[model samples]
Structures are given as C-alpha cells and as structure tokens.
Target: MAEWLYEAGIGENRAALVSRGTIWKARIELEGTGARVGAILNARLADRSTGKVTLDGGGEALCDPLPPGVTQGGPLRVRIVREAIPEPGRPKLPKAVPSDALPMPGLTLLERITASDVPVRVCRAHEPDLLEQAGWSEVLDEAVTGEIAFPGGALRLSPTPAMTLFDVDGGGPLEPLAVAAAHAVARAIERHGITGSIGVDFPTLANRAARAAVAEAIDAALPQPFERTTVNGFGFLQIVRRRTRPSLPELLRADPIGAETRAELRRIERLPPPPPATHMTTQRIARRLAQQPGWTTELARRSGGTTQFVSAKE
Candidate 1:
C-alpha cells in the first residue's frame, strides 16, 4: 500500500487514498490563491502491478480498477491541476465578427394564431400589414434584403407549423457560390431568432478548400443561444435553438399554399394571351397622357402607330 496527498486552490483541499489490499487516509492542504478557482487531485501507485485498489471507510475507489502490473516498493505519485474562474463585472469584447458584411439571406412570411379561447379572423390574402403591425416587418425585411445582396439566396415562407426554415440556394458557379450560400443562411438564422430545426443545403463544392471554408463560415455565423454541431465527414450542419416563445411562422398561423395554388399561379403568369390589364407596356405612356393638349386627337394618332397603347384610366 502507498499514501500520497494533493491540493489545488486556496482554502481547504480534500483528499482520499486507496491501497491494493488495504485503505489508507492522507491529509494535504492546498495553497490558497485568495480567489475563486477550481482544481483536481489524482493519486496513483508507484508499482505497475498491485491488488485491487479499494478506498477505506466506505469512500469511493480512487485508483484505476485494472492495475498495470505494479511492482512492490515503487514510488507513489500525486498530481493536481488548478483553474480559476473570472470574477463578476469583467468587461468582455465581442468575439464574433460583425454581421453587416455578411447579410442574412431569406424571405419570411408572417401569420398569427390565437389561443383556443381567443376570437380569430380569416383574411383573403396573406396580410403584410398585419405582420407589420405586430412589429415583425422590420425583422423580416432585414433578413430578406441581407440575404439577397450578400449571397445567392432568397427568403421564403417556411412550411412547417411552428418553425421557419431558411432555405439557402447556391445558384450557379457552384463552389464559391456554395460557400457564400452557407454563410448567408447562418446569418439569417441568427438575426431572425428562429428556433427549432434549421436545415441548410449547400450546393456541392468539388474543391476541398471551398468546402472547408464554407464550414468555417457556418461556424462563425451561428449564435451562442443555440447548440450547433457539424457533421463534417457527412457534410451537414445541424442547429438546435433554445426556444422560449412561438416562432414567426407559428405566430402568424400561415399555411404554405399547396401544389395546386402554385401551379395555378404559374399558369396565370404565363398566360398565352396578351398582357394583363396591370402590365406596363410603355414607359412614355403616362407622361404623354399627362401632357396631352387634345386627348381625343392624341389617342387617334397613337392608335394608327404600330405600338399598341392602353389607357391608364381604363
């Protein structure tokens, strides 16, 4: 059996000893630093082989369970490591880079849902005004504009019930664009206070350097409020946000239109017929109409020309 003592910070240091065949108690006092700190003490046998190490007086076992062939009469050694926590009121600088240069990319749609007992109103169109009234317009606008100008991205309504997913698209010129796309997605996630799962799909980058850079950019953009874990080997970034309140999607109670509505919109916009009533055909039409001295004669002259004209009032 061997005995040794170890100490860490100021104040009283605690210790316990265990022998292969028997238990022995040891006392050691740590030097005081007079400041709050943390330390760890470790005790080990001198001999490579010894009996099973057991603590005396019902204390927890200390030494490694498997003895590494300890020899008898070998010198026992004890080591201590100490660490100190900073005092309160310490000023800390921002460790993260500014988000100004790297704009958050993405579009956002807002919907509101009331509690079960609360009265609710259903409107015809997605109301941007209502979202503005709720104080979310600025946040959404900033996120979308940041994403568009900074990177190859666009913000869209997240289809999930209680979560908003900022889908980052790496449009064309794959490698460098993918890296920018990832950074933009990360920035949007942070600025919007989006909670729940955020899934970002980066375009495939053939170059190893480009991939690594994109990964680094992602790490830099995620905020501390959420736990971010990267699957580098698998090429994915997973984020878990600590959420307190319902996200924008949940608050807005907006449901993404189904495939039917999307197809209909495409059909209407690409209609084979002439332009719609609201379509702008000529840049000078408004000015010419405003300055017209004789409206009937001016209209008659324009009608004979090859250019088709539509009256603004009509």
Candidate 2:
C-alpha cells in the first residue's frame, strides 16, 4: 500500500508517497516562501484601477474583481488564490481576489498531506528516516542538477521565466527514443512537482505515424488535469498546468546555501548515538544554522547532544 510519509524538518517540510519501498512522488515546502494559497486576509486597496492591494501583513497582492464600490485605500477582505512565484530578477507576488470570507491562515504542509486520500504517516526523529531510506537524497540531487537519466537517454530540464523546457536526448531509433523519452518526461514532471508552462523537445520524426505513436505514449504516461498540444512536425509539445507555487528546482537552485544547510542537518541527525559535538563546515552554513535558533534547538533535542558550529576556515 502506498502511503504519504511526511517529515517536519528544520527550515522546511517534506512529504513523499512511497510504495513498494520506492518514492512515487515527493514535495518540499520551504519556510517563508510567501502567503500560502487559500489564505483569507485583510488588505488595503493600493490601486483600485489595477486591483493591486497591500496585505495587512507586509506583502503586495493583485486582487481582481474588486468588491463593488470599494474605494482606494479602503480595507477589503481577500482570499489568496496563488502563492508567490520566484523568477529570475524579482518574484511574482501572490494573487488574490476580493472575498467576504472570514480571515484564516492557510493549511500547513502537514495538514495538506494528511488531508490527501492516501494514508498519511508522520515520521519521528527517534524512528528510522523513512524518507531517506526511500531515496529522498537522490531526488534532491536530481532537482539541483536538472539531469534525469533514463534507460536509453536523459532529460535535461531547464526552468526559464517563460516555461520549463525538457530536452530529450539518447542514442537509438528516433521513434523508440521519443516514445521512451515521453514516459521519462512525464515521470520527471510528476516527481519534481513541476507546474505551469512546459515544453518538451523530442527527436523529430518525419513520419506522421511515428509522431502519433509518440503522442500516444505521452497521453498514456502523463496524467490528466493538464492541457498539452499535439506533437508538431518539429517534435515539440507544449503542456500547461495550473501554477501556484515554485517548483522543486526553483526552490533548491534559488537558495543553494539553505538547501545545503538542511541537507547537513539531515546528515547530522542520522549519526549514531552521541552525535558529533560540533559541525565544522563553511561559514555560510554556520551562519544559516545560527540564524535559526529553533533549528539548532531541534537538532540538539533529536541528536541528544549539544550542537555547535565552527567555521572550517580555522
């Protein structure tokens, strides 16, 4: 039976759907990403014409279909429809719309996973790390590297402002390679929690029949709830998914130092009894750990040993 295993790690929360001792799907929620989806809050109309509003807390949001007769600078309630998205230069703000609903905080990662149809298993520190045992680290590496190797070839995922592009390459017959790559592409998208616009570049097949076969492979592999164009003569297919939050690649690549810090914490927690007294690593990692006192406290509590950070420089 497949179960959703959730871990409340320091600075981030993780969840994985595991079956047959393998991870089928994984997700990570980083701390302080932004206002979560489904949160209703009060906002002051900043620009009535543009439907721009300032959240009561300290963020900007675009609220469309403004309530009737809402004046500029007037307080109005809004519900968050989408979380902020990270881009190259500046991040896109959370999107909301005017609402009369009561104000409430968004659901936490744990709450969301438990609400899923799959059985939920909350992992404990003292117990074995089920997520790691199910190949969590390898998935993280794949996200950071953007390289997923299949049997015949590999898919290079590149996330750009416009869309996430998957370039498929392998040595073999064009038809077979395209078909195999189609399944691989679907799996990668699902594994990485990739959403929004996506483009897959497969080996061009001149034969109409070959293109149809590749399309059929994609339709069988990828799940629904998405819109995709037919494989064109150029062997390019476009897919669109509902975008709310940043994908896994965006999170890891955006803050590599933070990712490393969390990974180090995971490593330290896995040590045998009487864990190391102090962790010696880069100054950046030391600073990151120090900034999160709660994380250090939890690390100490779990390891049953005092935790300290020393710069490797000395």
Candidate 3:
C-alpha cells in the first residue's frame, strides 16, 4: 500500500511518497515561502517587457504572447501555473490564463493527495521516524552537502546557478559502476525534487558500447519526460528537466544563516524528549533559533516536553 507520510512541524511541513514502505519521493515546505502554485490571486498587469508580464500584486512571470483580443493592464484574474525555482533562472509562469477559462487545477506538492490516483494516507506526526527509515533523513542531510551513495559507488549533487551537476565517485568496474551511478542519479533526482538543467559526470569511459549501456539504465530508471545528451567519451551527460518548484536542496540550503539552525531544531525533535527543562545550542544557532517566533513553544507542545531557552554567552 502507498502512503503519504506527513509531518506538520513548527518551522516547516514535510511529506513522503511511499510505496510498500519505501519512500519514493519526499517534499519539504518551509515557512515564508508562499504557497503560490495552487493560489488564486487577484492581479492586474503592472507592466510588460520582453515577453514577461509583471502582475500588480503578484510579481513578474514569463508568459507566452498574450492571445489577441486580450489586452494588458486591467483587473485580470490569474492563476499561478508554474512556480518560481531558484535554478536555471526565475519562474516563467508559462500557463497563466483567464481564471474564468480553465481546464483543471494543477497538481502540486502541497495538494498531492487530492490530485493523486494512488491510495493515500496522512502519516501520524508522533512517528517522525516512519519516513526517516526510508532514506528520508539522509537526503535532508544531503541537501546541505550533496553526497549520495549507491551499492558500488556514490555521487555528489551540487547545483550551480546555471545547472545542477552530479559527479560520480567510488571504486568498481567502470562501465558497471557508471550504469549503477546512472540509476542512482535518477532515484536521487526524484527523491530530492531536483529539476531544471542537470549535468552528470560519469567516470571516463572511452568505449561507446559501454556508454550506451549506461544511458539505457538511466532511461529505465527515470521514466519522466526529459531531454538529454548522449554520454560522450569524456563521460559527461547533460539533461534539462521541467522545473516545477524549488528543489529540496534549494529550499533547505537557501539561506545559510537559518539552514543550520532549522536543521538542528529538526534533529532535536527526533530525539527522545529530554526532561522538561532548558536546552542549549551554540550562541550563533541560539540566536537564529530565537528569530523564529513561537517555534520553541511549538516544539515543546508537539514533543510533549517543555523546553526553554535562556540567553547564553559564548
């Protein structure tokens, strides 16, 4: 049976798509990142330039040429079709249309249950480790330092401003390991919600036949529609995937100042509740944690333990 393991935490919301007890995909939504994908916003055309329309209240979104008879700059109802992602440039809201004329709502991370055809269940919050068992926690950590492992080898995932890159590592037979890396890469991409341009650096393999085998493995692993380059002699393959929302790493690693602080708090939640008392972290982390209003109390409430933070000196 498939289940949607959900945890509504104080700082963020998370969900895991699991099939037969193994998590296939994971999602995280942090506070302050507006939920816009399914949001119906009242907007007016503020400006238009170079194939982009700036909405009055909603920010600029790239759009196709406005259909004839549809003029710009009037009270228009617009729905956010595609969300803005940090990589490969800003969001090009390619599917905004007249709210009166619509087909159906878009499926989003926030609204997966209703949109999904699979049987779904909301996991209990007390069992935070339910999703953690199936590589969920490791991927969260990988969001900070992009390390992922397969049986024979491992790959590191890092996103540059232009594209996300996957570098293959570890020891094994070149062709077989490259094939394994390709499979692992596809799984990691799905699990991490990675999209946009991606470049995979497989270990150098001069033989075209061997490279063909690796490509086949990748195609089998990731059935999602994507445009990809053939593995060259230098062992580099580039793929460009459709971007929907901010990836897991992009959402988590967005601001260094808050990332570690939020991560530590999450770690603390998973621990067996300490005696009802004060807890301490480094002064830097403590200060960041303090910035999140009401989180300490919320954590206490959810964990069934009371934790108070007192100002500390270095």
Candidate 4:
C-alpha cells in the first residue's frame, strides 16, 4: 500500500509518498521562508500604479486587479496565489490577487500530505528511518545533481527563470531513447514537483510518426492538470503547469551551502551517538551551519552529542 512518510526535520519538513518499496513523489518545505501559497494576508498597497503591495512582514507582492477605489497605501486583503520564487541574483516577488474572503492560514506540509487521503506515517528521530529506507537520500542526490536515470537513457534537468529544461542522453536508437525519455521526464516532473514552464529536448526526429509516438508516451505517462505541446521536428516539447511553490531544485540550488549543511546535519543526527565533535567542510558550509544555532542544538539532541565546526583550512 502507498503511504506518505513525513519527517519534521530541523530546518525543513520533508515528505515522501512511497509504494512498492519506491518513492513515487516527494516534497520539502523550508521553514521560515515567506508566506506560503494559499495564505490570506492584510497588506498595504505600496503602489497603486504598479499594483504592488507590501506584506505585513518584510516581503512585497504584486497584486493584480487592484480593488476598486482603493487609494494608494490603503489596506487591502489579498490571497497569495504564488509563493516568492528564489533565483540567483533577483528573486521574484510573491504574487497575489485582491480578495474579500476571510483570512486563512496556509496549509503546512503535514496538512497537505494528509489531504492526499493516503495513510501517513510520521517518522521520529530515534525510530527506524522509513524515508531513508525508501531512497530519500538518492532522490535528494538527483535533485542536487539534476541527473535522472531511466532504463535506456538519462535526463539532465536545468531549472531556469523562464523555464526548466531537460536534455536526454544515452547510447541507443533515437526512437526508443526518445520514448523512454518521455516517460522518464514525466516521472521526474512529479518526483521533483517541478512547475511553471518546462522544456524537454529529445533527439531530433525527422519522422513525424516517431514524434507522435513520443508525444503519446508523454500523454500516457504524465498526469493531468498540465498542458504540453506536441513534439516538433527539433524534438523539443514545452509543458506548462500551475506553479504555486518552489520546486526541489529551486529550493536546493537557491542556497547550495545551506542545502549541504542540512544534508550534513541529517547525517550527523543519524550517527549512533558520539558523533564527531567538529565537522570539517568548506568555509561556506561551516559559516552557514554557524548561522543556525537552533538547528545544531536539535542535531545534538537527536544524536546525543553537541557538534562543533571546523573549516577545511583548520
């Protein structure tokens, strides 16, 4: 039976749906980010001309369809349609629309998984790690490396501001590789929770029937609630899905040092007592770990040993 395994980690909440001894889908919610999607907030209209609103806290949002007769700098009720997306230099502001509905808090990771109607098994620190048993770390590696392997080929995922792209590569006939890539792309899409626009570049096929076959494979593999273009002569296909929150790659790549630190914390916490006093790593990773004392404290509590830090030079 398929079940959702949730772990309230130190800095983030992680969940994975597992069935048949494999992970079908996964999600990670980093705590203390910005207002999540589906949150209703009272914001001040920062600019009527641009329809920008300042959230109660320290974030800004773009509000569409400005409320009628709402003066500039006036209070407005808005619902978050999309969470702020993190990028390299300039991150996108949260998107919202005017709403008169009652205020409501956003759903947490646990709530979202429970809403899926699947049996949820919450994992504790000292319990047998079900998520790791289900290849959770391997999935994280795929997200970090952006390489997903299928039967006959592999897909390289690259997430960009405008769209996420996938390039198929392997040693095989173009037809079978393309077909296999189509299904692999579908599975990866769900596994990573990739949203917004996505592009897949398969081996170019001059044969129209072969392209149709690839498109058919995509249709049969991917789930609904998304729109995709047919495979063209260049073997490029575009897919668009409703994006509310950041995907796995977006979360990890946005702050690589932080991701590495979190992974290290996970490893240290799982070690059978008497973990190393100091973890040696790059300066950036060590600095990031120092910034979050609470996380280190939690790790100490879980591992039965407090952790110190040392840079590679030391």
Candidate 5:
C-alpha cells in the first residue's frame, strides 16, 4: 500500500509517495507555483506583437500567440498554462485557451495527491527524510555529485544545456550485476525527475549479444514515452524524455521553504523564557502555519507564551 508523507513547511509543502519504504513520487508545492493551470480568465491584448496580455486580475501575462485575424488591445479569453514562477514578471498563458478548459480555482498539490485514496500523514513532526527512508542513499549521492557508484564501476550523470548524461565506467564481467546496474539507473532517473535527453556509457562489450542484452535491459527499465539510442561500439546510449519545467537539481537548489521553516523551528527550540507573543513572517508562511493547528498548539505548550504569526508587512 502507498502512503504519503506531507511536511507543511513555511513557503512550501513537501510530499512523497512512500510505498515499501521507497519513494515512488515526490512533489514540492510552492506558494508561487500553485495550480493556476487551466484557469480561464477574461483578458485583453495589451501588445499582440510581444505576446503580452492584460488579465482582468490586473498585471500582464505572457500569453500564447493570438489566433489569426485577432487585433491588439482586443478583448480576449485565455487560460493560464503555468503558474507564476519566481524568475519572471508574470505567469505564461497558453496559445489557445481550449473551451474545454475548466474554470477551476487553484487547488493545492498535496490535496490532489492525497485524494488518490492513499493514506496521508502529516510528517512535519518527524521531519521526514524521504530519500533516506528509501534506502537509496548512494543513488541520491549520485544525483548530487552526478555519479552512481556500484561495487565495481559507476555511472556518472552530468547535465549539459541539452541533456543529462550518464557515463558508465569500469565495471566487471558479471552480466547479472550489469543488468542490475542498468535497472538502478532507470530507477534513479524516475525517482530524481531527471527528464529530457539522457546518455549512458555502458562498459564496452566485444560480444554483440552481450551489448544487445544490456541495451534491452536498460530500455525495459525506464518509463514510457521516451526515445533511446542503442548501445554503440564505443559503449554509448542515449535516452530522451519530454521535459517542461526545471529538473531536480534546479529545484533542490532554490527550495527555501523547508530550510526556512526548520531554521525557525530551531530558533524556537533554543529560545529563552521571555519569548515574543507575536511571530512575524511573510504572509505565505503565516498561512501555512495557520493550516497546522496542532503545530501551533504544540508551540504554545512548549514556549511560555501565546504566539500568533502575522505577515511581516502587517
């Protein structure tokens, strides 16, 4: 059975689909990247040439190209394709707002995940570590350093502007072990969200059948809707998976909610008796803490004061 571990950190909610002690899926929901997809909005073309549109909600959206014969500043309807990410001025709208796109409010990602009949547990107290729980520490290490080390050899994963490359280096002649390594690579890719093009450098095999079998082994291990290159004479194979957003490395680097929450928690732990009654943070963090009633109750129980979180701007 699959269970989901949810940690409602300050600015984001981190969730992992844990089954058999392995993380099958991981999701990080930030305040900025909420579910704005498919949101129908009344808009006007502020500048069709530059693909900027003014939404009814105020502020510009980088909309997709208008259908032919549409004029600038004309009243139009568009659907948001992606939510507001931190990098840009405005979220982007799709080229065509399909009439079928539902007019749905943004739903939190964790709500959608737990709605799948999976047993959901609030894991902020345990301070859950999904990667360690999976017992794939080495695999995760590879994700960090770009190398998955096995007993004999290792697969080096590197990211280029185009694709993530996996170079297999220095393994022995154990066919079964080689096959296992191939499967491990596939699992790593899926678990870490290593999307887009991938290249693998398998140990060069003189025998045609051996090379073919290794290729098949790796091909079977990976997920669907991907293209791959067969193992070449120089022992290289490439796989390409469709990509939209940034990969794991990119997310992990900029992920701040968890770290910030933990930092605040640590400060609370070491706080002296005269703690402040008012806790200040961004509105986003305050909202998340409000959702965790039990956490606030516990906070009050530990510290000798009734504490309330408010947005810093307030």
Candidate 6:
C-alpha cells in the first residue's frame, strides 16, 4: 500500500490527514484574527495482506478485518501539517460604464438552440453598453416566453450569454412543421443578434427542391437589419445582424430549466425522499399493469400472498 500526507491552514487553525496514496491539497490565505483553533489529523492502511487500519487525531483504532472473499493490500498512512502565512490585499472591482454610451465594437457572439424532446435556446454575445443599461431584465423576459411553433411542435426559448449551439431534430413529416421551424430559426438569429461563425443543422431532406425552399424561406424571413445572409453549398445559412448593444440574451441571468419544468422532471425521474413512493411512478406502473391486467394477480398468487395496492404519494 502507498502512504500519503496532507497539510492545510496555519498556526492553531491547522489540520492534517494521512491515508492511502490518493490525497488532495489546497492553499488558503488567511486574514486578521489569529485566534486559537483546533487541528485534526487522520491516517489509514489498506492492502491485500492487511485489510485496513484507521487512525484519527486522537489516536489509532483497529478495524474489523475484511471477509475471506475480499482482497487485501499493505497499510496506508496520511499526515497533514499547517503553518501561518501573511494575508494579501483584497481584489478591486472594475469601474462601471455610463448608461448612455454605446457598447464597444468588434465583439463576438455565439448561440446554441436545441429542440428535440425538449426546447432550449442559448445566446452568448459579448458584454455591451445597451445590455448593461437595461440591467438584463428585458432580455430575460423576451428569451423565456418567446415560443416559436413549427408544424410538428412548438419551441420555447432558453437563453444564456455563453457559447450557444443549436441542435435540430426531425419532428416527423408535415409541410407546415418544416416551414415553421425554418422561420423560428431565422427569428432566433435576428433576435439574438448573433455574429461570428454560425452553424445550423436542419432536418435532412431527400428532395433537393424542398431543401432549396427551406433555404429560401429562411432568407425571406430575415429582417433588413441583417445586412446579408447566404446559404452555403453544405446547407448552412450564414448571416450578419446589425449590432447596437449587447444581444438581449447576454444581459440576462437564467437557467435552461424552469421551476415547473423542474418539478415535472423530478416526477419523470421518480426521484424523492425514500419510503414514500411518487404518484407519477405509481401511475406509470399502474398504467402498465392495466395494459396487462393479469400480471399483478398472477404474481400475488404465485408468491402465496394477497396483492396489496397502495396509492402513490405526490
């Protein structure tokens, strides 16, 4: 077995731990008070020949040996040491810019959109003056409620000011669905004011004319503020939108998952405290049983017991 030693903190506030070879180290700078504090240390041993031995700050204690089937190794040891160090100066915050001024130019923007089993929208535009002025309130509001419906299903926006990528999925064959999806993509590009490299993956189309039509629809939907947009040979539509401020998504602080959606998700995953089963899970199981009504009764009879059905907890 390998031995490892670790130390942290300084003076009376120090702590140490020793164990098998695996160990972690961290450096922390302290300030002001040098009050008396307690220190802790631990050690352990492990291997095929010897099961495991553990030691704490107080002293070492023998542990029950492993079972015959288990493999053993050599003893493991850990140690920690602490020492006092001088404190450092606090970090300074950047000065705020005036609201009226326009954001600096030559900033890059990126966004990702997803619409498969769930819909998500993300945007990552460089920080800008206009966005700072609005305090990010307006941008957040627009991104969440903005629902774009395709013929197959509708997509709701989920924006972020970090790198964004859009993933497209086929929602089954429906003419209106394809057109609506294309339009939604066009609007998202304009609304986010995304710049730099942009890539979009659309549903695969077997017919060349249908592909051309989708590209044409995207071109027509774009607003005049977007100076130019071209469809490349590989079926990617590129565009440059006029920028006056940071894109709306940049200013907002929101997550991809909302409260209601999170709650629904928990139900779907059947996650909750133990003992109480979730109603959602119970209902799903019940539905399955209903589909094959004889399963429950047959299981109970084979097990030599009466079947007990309990309602699921919410």
Query: Which number leads on TM-score?
Result: 4
Count of steric clashes across candidates, in order: 17, 0, 0, 0, 0, 25
- Report the number of the highest-lDDT candidate: 4
Residue 266 error for model 6, in Å? Answer: 29
The TM-score measured for candidate 2 stands at 0.95
Model 5, runs deviating above 4 Å: 34-65, 79-102, 105-107, 115-118, 126-143, 150-152, 174-178, 254-314
Evaluate model 5: give its TM-score. Answer: 0.65
Runs off by more than 4 Å, candidate 4: 274-276
Q: What is the TM-score of each candidate against the true structure?
A: 0.33, 0.95, 0.83, 0.95, 0.65, 0.31
The sequence of per-residue lDDT tens digits that candidate 1 reaches over residues 37-146 is 11112223332343222212111112333334444432222211111211124311101111112222111111111222323333211223232233233443343333
Candidate 2 pairs with clashing backbones:
none
lDDT of 6: 0.35
State which candidate, 5 or 6, has the greater TM-score.
5
lDDT of 1 at 20: 45
lDDT of 3 by residue, 57-173 (tens): 446655444434545675555566667665334533434544654333445455765467765556554455777677676767877789887899888989777888999998968
Model 5 has an lDDT value of 0.63
lDDT for 150 (candidate 4): 91
Residue lDDT tens for model 6, 8-117:
11110111111232111111112122211112223344343433333333333223333334333433332211111111232111111111222222111111111122
Lowest summed lDDT over 10 consecutive residues: which window, candidate 3?
Answer: 86-95
Worst 10 residues of 5 by lDDT: 85-94
Query: What local lDDT score does residue 309 receive in model 4, on the 0 to 100 scale?
Result: 83
Which model, 3 or 5, shows the larger TM-score? 3
- Best to worst by lDDT, what's the order? 4, 2, 3, 5, 1, 6
Candidate 1 residues lying further than 4 Å off, grouped into runs, are 1-150, 155-164, 231-235, 254-314
Model 4 lowest lDDT segment of ten: 264-273
Higher TM-score: candidate 2 or 4?
4
User: What is each predicted model's overall lDDT from 0 to 1?
Assistant: 0.36, 0.88, 0.72, 0.89, 0.63, 0.35
Alpha carbon deviation, residue 304, candidate 1 (Å): 55
